[model samples]
Target chain A: MTQTSLTLCCKVLCVESDDDKPLASPADSLALIAQERANLERDLTPDPRWMFWPWGFAWLLGFGLFFLRFGPDGRVFVDLPEWLPLTVLSLSFIAAGLITGIAGGRSAMQTRGPSSRQGLMYGLTWSIAFTGMGILFAQYGDALPDDRLGLLWAGGMVALTGALHMAGGAIWNDRQLFILGAWTSVINVAGILVGPGWHSLIVALGGGLGMILAGLLGWLRLR
Target chain B: MSDGTELDPVIHAQARLRVVSALSVLREEDKVTFPRLQESLRMTAGNLSVHLRKLEDAGYVEVTKTHQGRTPATFVRLTRRGRLAFEEYQEALRALLNPTSPSTSSEETL
Candidate 1:
């Protein structure tokens, strides 16, 4: 038989070639199957990094925008009174989430649905990192660590934001959404503890400008 | 493509590709049941069974028969050779896509 014909025949008539047993002997078959699969594996592609880039972008943008907007070296809204920085940071996060959601939707089409467990884990990790940064900054600000009220407030915000991201991730299977939810949730509470002074300028720039960059990158990729 | 090491075209169709990909994602401690594999690949039982049998005959998979209550169940797990072959297959594909990578040889990497 021609090679193609033989293959076609095999495809069409899938019955075990050996008539004696409908079920093949597992011991005999296992080795051959393993060999074949090894051959197949030599041709498979590793998991694509693009699949998770949006989530990574969302987190990075939030962090970067916050720092740039509020850090001692920032200049985005210098005219604003000291009390306005926290409010600006909170607004930036909310706005970033909205914009990232819209822009990321385009790039997201190429990927499989985000794994909820993975997304939640990412959200929790992001929250912890954000909290740690906040505490470290407070220490540098020369504030006492035993300032229990401030820590409690920051912790509550972080937890709520993290929960929101977890829920969003589970719902849409979008790690980006999960990430945004966490940021907004944290920013809402951070506004209270850190106040709208120069401290908040960094948060606003990091969250807002970072989101803008992600949206731009997503657009570039889509185009 | 079969050259002793490569999976032949007969085994590289999209349906089988999906099956292999799904199986690859499964946890090492977990085995995939026939129905789960079928649903994930969106293939009929008969169709999946046929491809599965081909895989089985090639010595890549271990089919376990067990009783779940009164019903019989078939669970498929990749044998060590299957895992190795799959990993090698992946390396070959990557080499094809990335010829500059040092892991890829000069002639066949493209």
Candidate 2:
């Protein structure tokens, strides 16, 4: 009785004739029943593109790299003689993740149940929250210096964003969101290598353009 | 004819019952699309049209024709009488299900 199955049943029952008239009889109730069974099985298949573990593992890789570079010297990622600019950039990345996850999640729930759009939205929402909280802790707290804080923040946010994406993917029954989450993890690693300027652009493009495309794909398919 | 009575059993069969359930979902919403109902009920367009004509004859539902994009869409809604009849039918069903209940026996006595 899922909506897709119901729609498929309707499509199967429709007569393909030139005349815009109704059929004389119910026209093979058995056929409709058979079609329904097939569709139900198709709906039950699990998607393969789950992203949570992959992103976590990637962040772990980044964590190792960060420690390798700065651990011996006892300087964190942000403490490499960099200014307060990295702090500002981290804050922006976190904000973007939060905004996308919360708003996109709501919109996806409203429109298409748990389709691709919902997964994308949910991923965006988590991204914003995940990144934002990390940046907040890095800047305002009495914990560690900026560079070390940045490494810790990036590792934690990348892990979280990946987890959210995986959850959304499972809920929507789509792997695309999982892939996006994995991409965010990779982007985080890239950010570590490229410095703040390049990281900001990458995060914007990944969250912004990526979400718009997902939304458009849903609109086209549903409409 | 002078007193209010329930609809005939013959008129309450297959297509009409399907129409009733479909219309029930649209009681709060102003209207539902023709194609939407036809698809929901898994009925052919002509079979649906025939049942719809009967409902229209009974003054229980209204149909409006409009264009969605280039295609003609028929929107349907239950009339006030249709809503009342549906409620009355539900009440009767509840009574039938619990005929020995105190409230029902008392009403029967009355």
Candidate 3:
């Protein structure tokens, strides 16, 4: 933007030539630009907290049921059918995926342009990442005892999710997203260390509630 | 690049100034659709087209036309020089607001 390049005038008022007066005072112009810049920032990045709600609830309900069914000592507390805990986990994750997908897709459509493309790619990356994890786990999983097998599955999935969340945060430059990822990793490690039954309980309470808290914080900041 | 002493007319005009300000907020690699820009600024296509042409001629903005699937889309972004100019313009505005004050800008000279 060369100084000499500008030749326009509202009736020839622009430039160092100073033939015309500005509609906005210099102070007002600065303020207007500041306001406009903030507006663009808001539009470009809508509040992302809404995406976290489904995931939070899914983890809470799913893991809570797991904790109740498989207790801290691996003894059956609720006496649910053998298929119930795993089914609950599977269904909860699927539901979360569907809900977040719909919400993210709607946001992408509204934001449109590069953001939508980025969102699609990001969503695909999650699928590929989790699929890779599932395949890897299947290969070596049978060697572990039943209790260890459950821990391995839960721990591995939670760890992968944390890593992906961190990646997402870095890509978006979102502090909350990055912090949530970090927190998830910490709680996941804690759950694994406490053994199978305790792992379920920790993840159910910590991992599940952590996401909800993060979402709540985002809501507060937005308000 | 300006020394924060004089405002650049390229961005001093009202509408173009707003356009440049809006663009400066984006990440450097990001490009916005022409319709999005127009809608955000609430300007008519003809009006935006005219200012964009001026900004383009001044090397302040880059416009690209590409296809999103089967539909053609036009995108716009500020050039690096354009970003520098906008920053300098802000500094110039700051100085204009308080004229007898000592200029603290690195670009200012004794």
> Best-fitting candidate, measured by DockQ?
3
On residues A112-134, what C-alpha lDDT tens digit does candidate 3 reach at each position? Answer: 44566887898999999899889
What lDDT would each prediction earn against the true structure?
A: 0.47, 0.50, 0.76
**Residue by residue across A1-223, what tens digits does model 1's lDDT show?**
2433333333233333334432222222333344434432322211223323343444345333433444433344335454453454456555644554444443222122233244345546655766666666555444443234333433444455456555756765757646655665666466545643332333334444444454455335333
Query: Which model scores highest in lDDT?
Result: 3
Q: TM-score of the second chain in each model? A: 0.81, 0.80, 0.86
Better of 2 and 3 by DockQ: 3
CAPRI grade, predicted model 2: incorrect
Q: What lDDT score goes with residue A181 in model 3?
A: 90
lDDT of 2 by residue, A115-162 (tens): 434456655575477557856765655677655555556555655765
Q: CA lDDT of A202 in candidate 1?
A: 35
DockQ of each: 0.04, 0.03, 0.26
Error of 2 at B18 (Å): 2.0
- Which whole-number lDDT from 0 to 100 does residue A53 have in model 2? 26
Better model by DockQ: candidate 1 vs candidate 2: 1
lDDT of 2 by residue, B1-110 (tens): 11011223322354575577556644243565676567666789999898888888888888888775797767777788877766554444344335466755555555
